[model samples]
Target: MRIYTRKGDDGTTGLYFGGRVAKDSALPTAYGTVDEAQAFIGLARAEAEPGSELDQLLVAIERDLWVLMADLATDETNRAKLVAGETLVTDAMVASLERRIDDLSARFTMPSEFVVPGGNRVAAALDVARTVVRRAERDSLAAAAPGSRVVAYLNRLSDLLWTMARWQEGDSLTARAVAPLAGEAEKGA
Candidate 1:
C-alpha cells in the first residue's frame, strides 16, 4: 500500500481497471475540473450561513461531485459496470438542481449583462465553482459514452451554481456590463 508506486513518474497513470493512460488524458481533465468545482463548493459551504439551506445543499453537491470524479477516474468499459447504485448521478439529480435553481432565480432579475464573479466570499467561491463546473461539463461531454450521464449532470450543475451564488449573495452583488454570451436571450425564448 505504498503511496509511491513510481509507475506514473513518466506522465502516465493507472485507471480503475488494468488500463493506463497519460496524465493529460481527457478523463482526468473532466475529473480534475470536477475536483476543482468540488473544492470551490467546499469553500462556499464553509463561508455560507451555518446550518442554512444553501449550506446543506452545497454539502450534497460536494458528495455528488465526488461520485462524478470516481466515474471519470475509470475508463468507459469499467465505468459502465460500476455498481455504486445510489451514488450514481442521474436525471432525477438534474431535476433536483432545476428546482433549486428556480427557487433561487425567482429572487433575481434576469439580465443581458455580464456580471463580475465576486461579492461575498461564499458567492465568489460559488462563481468559481460555476466556471469549473462548466469546464467539467465540456470535458465530460468529450469523455461521454453513448449512454453516459456525466456531461448532463455537469451542465445542470453549472446552472445551479450560478443561481446558488445569486441566492447566497444579493443579485446586486453581480456587476453590470454587456452580455458575454451571444443569443442567450434567444435560448431562453
Candidate 2:
C-alpha cells in the first residue's frame, strides 16, 4: 500500500471512527506527542543491552503508547467501538505503570532533588524519553475526553521512566553533578 495517502494534504486528519479534524487540533497534538514519546522510548531501547530488563520494559511501554494513541484518536461518539486492553487505555494500564514504578524505584536510591538527566548514553536517552512522556501527558490531559485514563497513564509513565533512568545509571546518578545529588557537596567545607 502506498504510504502517501495525500488525504491530509488539506491540513486535516481523519479520526478513528469516521470523522476529521484540523491537523493541529488538540486530539492530533496529543496523539502526536504520544507518538513522539514512543519514538524516544524506542531510541532508549536501542541503547539497552539485548534482552535485558530495561530493554524488555521499554518494549512494553512502547506497545502501551500505541494503545494510548488509539484511545486519543477515537472521538467520543465512537466510544463503544473501542476495545479495552486494545484501543482503550484502561485503569489496569495505569496500575501496571504504578507497579513498575514501584518495582523499579525500589532498586534505585531516590534522589532528594531534581535529576541532572544525563549520566551515560542509555540513561540520558531514557531521560529525554521521560521528558517527552511528560509533554505527552500534558497534551493528553488537555485533549482527553471525560473519564479517559490517558493522562493518568502518561503521568505514571514519566515516573517510571525517571526511575528506570536512575536504575540504569546506578551510582553514576549520584555522581553526575548538574545540580549536586541531594546534600553531598556540603558547600565549601
Candidate 3:
C-alpha cells in the first residue's frame, strides 16, 4: 500500500474510530504533541541500558501514549466505542504512574531546590520528554471530554518522568546560584 493516502492533503486528518477534523484542531494538536513526547521518551529509552528497569518503564510509557493519542483522536460521537486501558485513558493508568513515582522517588534523595536538567544524557532526554508531556497535558485540557482521564494521565506522566530522570541521574543538579569569581566581586565593590 502507498504510504501517502493524500487524505490529509486537504488540511484535515482522520480520527480514531471514525470522523475527521482539521489538522490544526484541538484533538490533533494535543495528540500530535503527545506523539512528540512519545518520540522523546524513545530517545531516553535508547539511552537506557537494554532490558533494564528504566528502559522497560520507558517502553511501557511509550505504549501508553498510543492509548492516550487514541483517546484524544476520537471525537465525542465515538466516545462510547473506546475501551478503558485500550483506546481510552483510565484512572488506573494515572494511579500506576503515581505508584511508579513513589517507588522511584523512594530510590533517590529528593533535591531541595529546583532541578537543572542535563544531569546525564538519559536524564536529559527524560527531562525533555517531561517538558513535552507538560505541553501535551495543557493541550489535552482543551480536547478531553468532560469526564475523561487523559489530562490526569498526562499530568501524572510528567511527574513520573521527573522522578525517573532524578533516579537515573543519582545526584540531581540544583538551580541555586553559585559564587562569583574574585574579579567580578572586586568590580562590584
* Best model per lDDT: 3
lDDT of 2 by residue, 33-133 (tens): 99999999999999999899989999999999888999999989998899998999999999999999888888878888777767899989999999999
Estimate, for each residue in 60-132, the C-alpha lDDT of model 1 and write its tens digit. 8888787777777778667656645243567777777788888878887654545566757888988888998
Which residue segments of model 2 deviate by more than 4 Å?
Answer: 176-189
Those runs of model 1 whose alpha carbons end farther than 4 Å from true positions after fitting are: 84-87, 108-112, 171-189
* lDDT (CA) per prediction: 0.77, 0.91, 0.92
Cα distance off (Å), candidate 1, residue 157 = 0.8
TM-score of 2: 0.92
Query: For model 2, which pairs clash?
Result: none
The model with the greater TM-score, 1 or 2, is: 2
Where does the lowest 10-residue lDDT sum fall in candidate 3? Answer: 171-180
Each candidate structure's count of clashing pairs = 0, 0, 0
TM-score of each model, in listed order: 0.81, 0.92, 0.92
